[model samples]
Target: MSPRNTRPTTPRSGTRQSPRVALTPRAAELVRRLRAEHGPLMFHQSGGCCDGSSPMCYPYGEFRTGASDVLLAELGVDGVAEPVGFWMSADQFERWCHTHLTVDVVPGRGSGFSLEAPEGVRFLVRSRLLTDDETRRLGPGGPSHGDASADTSAHSRSGGPGRA
Candidate 1:
């Protein structure tokens, strides 16, 4: 018998509210290890230029976020004191706002700047269209650091309520 590297960390059983972003179990395990080595961490997906399309992880506050960036989620991993913040460029978010992202670990050398690069594994994003319920729960503009309010209006499974 072989040991498994992945496990379910978030409730995907359709009972709990779904997050805009989540981590695969393997990714979560790696996050714990990285946290041990680097204190706290944050992730940013630039979606273009030097970063290419891979998500980059760094020690918290190492990367300077500006008004053009949006926080997509704060992912929780067991044994870690603070949640890992995941941010995306605002333009990228606007294009991908309809999808739910899952951060997964893959074997490859990604951006040299990402902390995990030296570990021989990289973080990547997997996505699926947000379920109708999830879209409404997350509200129209996606998650903001201070926003607690969500719009629960009825929107069809075909698409969210006009992306407004």
Candidate 2:
């Protein structure tokens, strides 16, 4: 006989939190422009240097936030009754919200958010760095995705203004 699927079919229980991020008119406009250009955006909190918490936005790909195994204490976010679309730590999610950005999950690539920027340039933030190949995929006017190596190399050699 075929083995029965053991995964829990029941949907997790929890209240849906309203997206309460706030943005200036300029920022909102920027978000709109980016949405019009790119298909969707993603948001995430990752383990980084210092306190080990940093927020990142992505243009594509699937990412998990607020998973069952994640510890609420570590994330530093509160008032969450259930795991949302992603497996973000409570604290990190709070920080993203504090930035006044709204997160959305798309059907194909992944989940992300749109932010309005005062500057005319629309920016894309991602949890992971973009590979050189991925940057090429962006066609034109997209932010750099790969390592800081590419960005820092020129500055190191130039010893420009900020350098000693």
Candidate 3:
């Protein structure tokens, strides 16, 4: 009988690190669903363009480790993170540990979160800004593109016109 090939392939290394966020129940559900549908998603914060912070979800294909963060390890079948046990760049891990923002895995339309900066600053993005590719990659029944506008309208209705 011929011996069978039993060599295991080495895992790929140096993927972008997942951002840290406080996950609400809603956000957690969204992450679970995305992982099942797509390979993996990424979260990042960019401060160059707009004033308000933005959250973005990237398809596995578009994800990369660009001096920002590196994938540490898979967080079971539901999520991922960069801890000592996982394969992460030293800088990425250090940044995650020291960042003042708190990250959570909650139920949301996509696998990302927004923060309200300490000084009453808003850190979120509009659904309209999401490209069709992002929506599609996020999979079915996830947060729709109109959700951003809808959220603003709901807030306006509750706060009324005269309130600061």
Question: What are the Cα lDDT values of the candidates?
Answer: 0.67, 0.29, 0.31
In Å, residue 100's CA in model 3 sits off its true spot by: 3.8
- Output the worst ten-in-a-row residue range by lDDT, candidate 2: 1-10
The local distance difference test score of model 3 is: 0.31
Question: For model 2, how does the per-residue alpha-carbon lDDT over 1-164 read when each residue is reduced to its tens digit?
Answer: 00011111122222222222222333334434444554343334454553244334433223332221121111101222111212234444444322223332222222123232223243322333434653443344311122222211122234421122
Error of 1 at 90 (Å): 0.8
Off by over 4 Å in 2: 1-19, 45-55, 60-62, 66-88, 91-164
User: For every model shown, what is its TM-score relative to the native structure?
Assistant: 0.76, 0.29, 0.33
- Quick one: ranking by TM-score, best first? 1, 3, 2
| 85: Cα error in model 2, Å | 8.5
Please give the distance, in angstroms, between residue 161's alpha carbon in candidate 3 and its true position after superposition.
48
Ranking by lDDT: 1, 3, 2
